[model samples]
Target: MSDKSKTQDEDLPYYDHPTGGWGSVKSLAKIIARSRPDPGIMQTLWRQNKPGGHMCTSCAWAKPDKPHTFEFCENGAKATAWDLTSHRCTPDFFAEHSVEALKSWSAHDLEMAGRLTHPMRYDADSDHYIETTWEEAFEGIAAELKQLDPKSVVFYTSGRAALETSYLWALFARLYGHNNLPDSSNMCHETTSVGLKKVIGSPVGTCKLEDFNECDMIMFFGQNTGSNSPRFLHTLQAAARRGCHIVTFNPVRERGLIGFANPQSPMQMLTSSRTKISEHYLQVKPGGDIAVLAGLCKRVLELEEEKNGGVLDKAFIEEHTTGFEAFAQSMQQTSWADIEQASGLKRTDLEIIAGMYANAKKTIGIYGMGLTQHVHGFVNLAMYVNLLLMKGHIGRFGAGISPVRGHSNVQGQRTVGISEKPELVPLDKLAEMFDFEPPRDEGRTTVEVVRGVLDGSVKAFLSLGGNFARAIPDQGQADPAWKDLTLNVQIATKLNRSHLLVGRKTWLLPCLVRSEEDMQATGPQAVSMEDSLSNIYGSVGKRKPAGEHVKSEMAIVAGLAKATLKPNPKVKWDDWLGDYSLVRDLIEETYPDDFKDFNARMFEPGGFYRGNPARERQWKTESGKAEFTAPKVLTALGELPGEGQYTMITLRSNDQFNTTVYGYTDRLRGLEGSRYIVLINPKEMADAGLSEGQMVTLESAVDDGVERRVADLKVTAYDLPDGCVATYYPEANPLVPLEYHDQESKTPAYKGVPVRIVA
Candidate 1:
């Protein structure tokens, strides 16, 4: 590590100070300095928050027609302010700096310079990036792509890309004979889709925001609602006020879950009167979620047998589900002693939760990456469904499952077909809609793509938005693998860490921001997004374009497609680029039943809701019922590190999103301006003969060889369960091996890793 890296590590303590005002001021300064946008420009952009403009790109929960006076959140303001930055990367700037020099700069510093003004090409001999014309850049990319095998090319999509852009990219990849779509979904919620599909026959949740108000009891498992999804705080507050019982189960006592002041409410904000959130909080050990869920279900089953003539939904199970007998037998086989030990919760606690469930007429379960980023993440989701099935929570007005997605358009991308292994039906339908036979072979996922690049199977990487290298685990392996790629193209509005990990030939193409107006040959364009509730809504940008030269993502994809693909009389790339509604029309044709009147419905204020099978208690399985799947118990359950070692979980701070670091401040943890401190129980600290704020190193107990040791980290005593510790993500992601992912979902096991603490 360099002196700068060492200094940053050493400054962790200062960042963790609990002084709120100073921290907020420091964060504001950081945001302004790092974004490097003119204050005047940002003020002008901020004024564009009119009635007809779309909601901020960071969060999709904003209500339309609401006054712009209270429209933005802290993160949303930062995102928009950053977009309005006046900095620009001219050809002279690139010519002055070598790729090696730029690579040395921090991720934030590179992006602070502003957006790419024109197309650029990497010069290998000079190790610098020089400006190039759009025609030359397209021609070079097309010539190289035509020589390589279609399978060798990887098309990566980020969450920031608009729906129209995503569809065009998918269309181009399919028309060019490739299905290699390694997207943002692969890193986040692939587990939710994979697990839900097997049991509910749909990859989406059935619950809407309205369901939160109607539920009698709400159980939040393995999710940090306050930090991961702040908008959920409003729902939680409303439910609490309505006398609904709310329970939170996680390793950390998240502040947002405890209570929150509605920033939008003038009275609440001015008076500082906060609404209490959780009635009960259970801090369970990391990776112990499966045991906790199973225990609750077991207790519910026992209660059902005693009072409700067996707690199982006999009618629903028999009529719509399969494999009940096997699943019940497995539950019967699980001993209470094992469950108590693994979950670190008493038997009475389980009964209390179960009693609440049994008495409630309806309940809604909400989860985030915490539950899905585990080794048995898919199984964890299945267990959640199993609990719902036992009580017949599906097909009801107030009861269902909701998985809070991270990005605005992530679900939209999946809806428009950005999958590595797209189903045959969709491929066949696309072939009929576009007059081209889509590739039937399976493509590479995120991890698989990295591995392919390492082994020389993949040649190119075309990313639409995210910083993949930083977001993915196993950076030690990925950094070298990234250098081996033949071409790396990023279509983004700003710079990020992934841009530094350049390939043999790299290109950075500037694109319009989501909040910016997208004008093409056709006219003004409108994009669509699918929310967590499976509701598809139209988003129209009313703000002017950030830069005159910047193009919408759709136009960029179209240009690339026209340049690379073999000439086909049937496909009209230019026509689709001219009008995005035509792309929606094609999407409607491909998925006729779901997207009828694609253009007409989108004109409605809130857009349309997609089909959800669980809402009607309809299971699309072969047996016309939901299926019960019992996971096999691994023999490694009882095993632990020799001594003085416990499981470690990675989490996000209240001030930051995935890789986009707005600032280093975690107000909920009482840690301000810091991203590198470990939270440990005071008892655990004393048991290890350590004091608060003692420097310690964490060593991975797993044999995956991924290790991260931070010296002199402030050990703030927290109310976490025994044998469990917590730290922030990306910083702690290095401790998780790429192979330590859920088998069924292929999502990284970020929440659970065995580790030892040392001085």
Candidate 2:
């Protein structure tokens, strides 16, 4: 390996701050230098984050009404500068380097190489990618797809695409007679959509930024808000200053949950003083979230019995809910002993939390992957809603459940048909508009798609963005399946590992990023993006294109649709690609209730809210009320480490977002210069006869008979729950088994993985 690639903890220095501070500014400078952008690039950044301009392609945390001089965050700068980077991966670059040579580099090193500049086709004979014309690439994919069964074709989307592109993606898939759709959301928060739909009759969240301003209590369970969504720090800091009590539960005591030094405020930076965030931090063990929540629900019921005055919302429960008695009985039968053993927390700890929730008039609950990436992920979500329903936390401001969504527009992708199972209501609307019978079969998810590929049931695969080979679980199985596909195609901005893993015939279509201008027949056009809060607005690129050959994602999608699907007068691909307004008109017809006058609403200052009716106490269930479904079991963590085993949960480093690794330094956790590492409890390390900084291998404890091991990962002692360990995801993804998933949502159990340290 090269000297730069041989990273260890010995040479690099680590820094710690209360979330955002001067450290972020210094880190931002380092990223800009790495991008090697022109001095005039500042002008592009200045105009890129405006209302009518392209939205910041980083985190989906909603921007404030009152914009700052520099509106973007530290990570946002990295994402934009990454696109504006002068480094280009032309055809010559690929020709000079073999596929095997690139495989030796780290994910961060590969991404830092630069943006792709032209369409390319993989040549198996030479083991290198060669330049190809757009027509040749399109025809190659069309011929192969037309020869295969439409059911064998799988379509996947990342959270990065604009609404214009996503709308066309859904339309084209139905026109081509297939519904095997899967997106990034299936990996992240499918539980929130599925679980919330069962409980509240809606898959969307009810709380807004205004809720944090008015809520008496904010319970942050399993969320590292400061690191994942830094823009949320502004609202969190404001609430802390206004005397709102914050409670947090997680395996790690994240610095963001403890305190904050607002980098956005010059005064806060000058003082170098930090403001405390969570008043109480409960360190719950991994896979033990359900027990803690269940214990709290039982305590609330006890408090209601003793107080007898106004503990439970009796009127609201009677008027707007069902199945309460059944839920209450389940909570009662769940003993404190079982709760303590399962949750790894004492009854007193849960009682303290229960009392806090009971006293608060208004409460907002927020959670993340800690709860969603478990085998009982769906039940974990239901338990939270059950607790909230006991106190009537929904259908009002300052009180509701928020699953803390991860990508910039992941929720938006689902809002506009990037789904495997499109709702019947939307299907009827699409059938009426296009004069085509929508596919009635239940679609496939990410896991299902991978299984199809492995069994030879699936023949072709197409991706808009995201590196599926690295992002999904069971790399040992998924990677080879991708290589053996009949055809593989990717429409992407940068070169990822997935692009290098070629099938019989693979094509990489270069597309313009959010920072580059999208010129079309209808002149300069602006696309739309939806935030986690369901706010939709226009985003137009400001700067010149990095490559003359690169096309917009919308154009690429339309072109592929025209090439594959036979001509139909109702489906006008060229018109939609040329004028994006025509696409918005189609979306308006698809969801009239939500996107009414979408073309006219695009002109709104920051876009429309696309409000959720559940927020207004209108639960459109079979009974026209919120129905509670209690889990039969209180906790899903059956047992702790067996002999020399540990329950592992995959995590993201501070310097990265999703699968994109910007650097090896994770400032929040105080590690640097390596992604191949594991964090273990010091006590557990001593018991396992392991020492800090020891190079070791991890073998899965699951007896699937598939030897899944991650070797050469250095061990580091950390302050985590005993018998529990953590490692950065996409690196440890191989250790996760495809069979280990939430039964209800099919989300892989990334947090509940069972493994043993190998000598």
Candidate 3:
């Protein structure tokens, strides 16, 4: 760490202004200046979220049918500028920095070094990456893969992969006779899938983009809309303009939820005026979402007793949902004292929130990682569904659940059959189309893959995109295990720390990003992605490829498939490589209901909605109806932090998206120049005898005896709940044990790790 990275307690600036507006605009400009200026960034911005434009490569917020001239947000612009920058990480650059030295560089420095220009292999002797031919790389990877058992290799996919690439990647895995497909969702929103599936019969959110407009109330559960999904702020601002109640339940009162000034709005930009959001904001504990939700439900049930039949939606419950009686009985038995202790909110506050929900004719419940990245994330989601079901929110116009997904197409990748559980996919249909028997046995997830590698069971690993080492929890264990792998391959646009985790035969294959033109033998091609709201849209990059050697993710997958698998007459890899439409046709054949006319739909105004069964009231569960779940416990973690320990909430800065850090400044949180600081409540800091700007080490409180700690982190006092602290993710991920995760979903409990600060 440099001296410039050090912080002074008195020098910390408190941001009194609203989020977005000029601040967001200035931040984007700063990033553009820091990164080599790209002249075409504005042109690319104009096309983003438009009919024929590329999807914003950041958040999965749905694109509107009739979009604005600039549909991207400040964070979206940063992503674009970051991708489109002229800086290149060519072989010459690699010759200068050794792999070991590069490992010590900050994540932002590594990414800013720029896009990889050619295929390269890690030379163990020289400790540097040397250029390698694509053919040699493919042949080497294929040879190793052929030697290893399919079950011993893991194919990791990132959410950045479009549906076209993901479908082909999944097909490639199936053709190779394995289902070891662990993806980004396993580290984030797997709970949303498992929990929502059992409750609403759909793994995805039930709401559409238009729901925000017609909904009477928008309730946010642990979503930092401003930084994570800046585009969603426009919807919230519009809803606020219509007098719709905007409520928030999170440990931190994020700037986005407090107020927003849309950069695209001329009046607001000119006057520096902002729209106030979060009509009601409650600061709940880090892992207290489930308890808070239960409290809301309990208050609603009590209101029903007071008002008799008027409070409960008896018609919707009896007609479209089941298990309501059990859910209501459980809520009736919930104690106020228990709820208050678990959540840091008072009973009166919860009652007020319940009154708002009951009075609203229609409501939309939106949540993010805060609710889904915990030990009891699955139960928390189930409880959230119960709250919505009590008032008949699902399947109704403008009333449903929305999980604000990170990554551009994380949901799309899952929808295209990237799952460890093969039963979730249409294996029979795939077998019929590809002339091969698809693997039906369950495979490994992200955490399982980490354990597999550590135990020497997983010999080879491949990633379509994403920084596997940095993104996954327990990096202390997983990082060192990468060297034990027989082969490691990465298909990415830029260089990340994960690329440095070289194995015996490691290969770094460069691929074109969504902002680059994907030129195939046939013509320029467009890949499709499904947003958080199930909106499928085509993204065609207007800029030239970063390098002539950079191939599209689809082409890379096809090449690998051709190299590894024998010629299958039914599956035409060569033809699909030339024309992606052929791949879409095969996808349509496999998923007839969802992707019927998939190619043609790419030309639609904003593409099309994939259509959620729950939205139409067509439940696909065993009961054939939306079912309410009675949570066994109300707390998210089912335990309290021990004395001298606090629940550590992992977070992302304004300049970050997932593991990709564009810069260190988190302007929204009044943080700058560094990402190594921790936020603690002032009262708690005093209780611990810790001064602001004091360097401390955070050690995991788990009894695993495998000490996990991050040292040299400066502590700063902020407005957080007692016994809770916050730190940047990836940096703080080591404190979260790989085994400590949601039991049902296997999603790491990144947001709620118990740790103690040592001075």
Q: Where is the poorest 10-residue window by lDDT in model 1? A: 1-10
TM-score of each: 0.91, 0.96, 0.98
Most accurate candidate by TM-score:
3
Question: Which tens-of-lDDT digit does each residue in 260-372 have in candidate 1?
Answer: 67766677655656677788888776766778888887787788778857555678777777887788778878988988877787879888988888788888988887788
Model 2 residue 749 CA deviation in Å = 1.0
Q: Report the lDDT tens digits of candidate 2 across residue range 692-750.
A: 79999998898878999999999987777877888998999999988778778888888
lDDT values for all models: 0.74, 0.83, 0.88
Clashes in predicted model 3: 0
Compare candidates 2 and 3 on lDDT and give the better one. 3
The window of 10 residues in a row where model 3 has the poorest summed lDDT is: 1-10
Ranking by lDDT: 3, 2, 1
In model 2, state the lDDT of residue 759. 71
Best prediction by lDDT: 3
Total clashing pairs for each candidate: 2, 0, 0
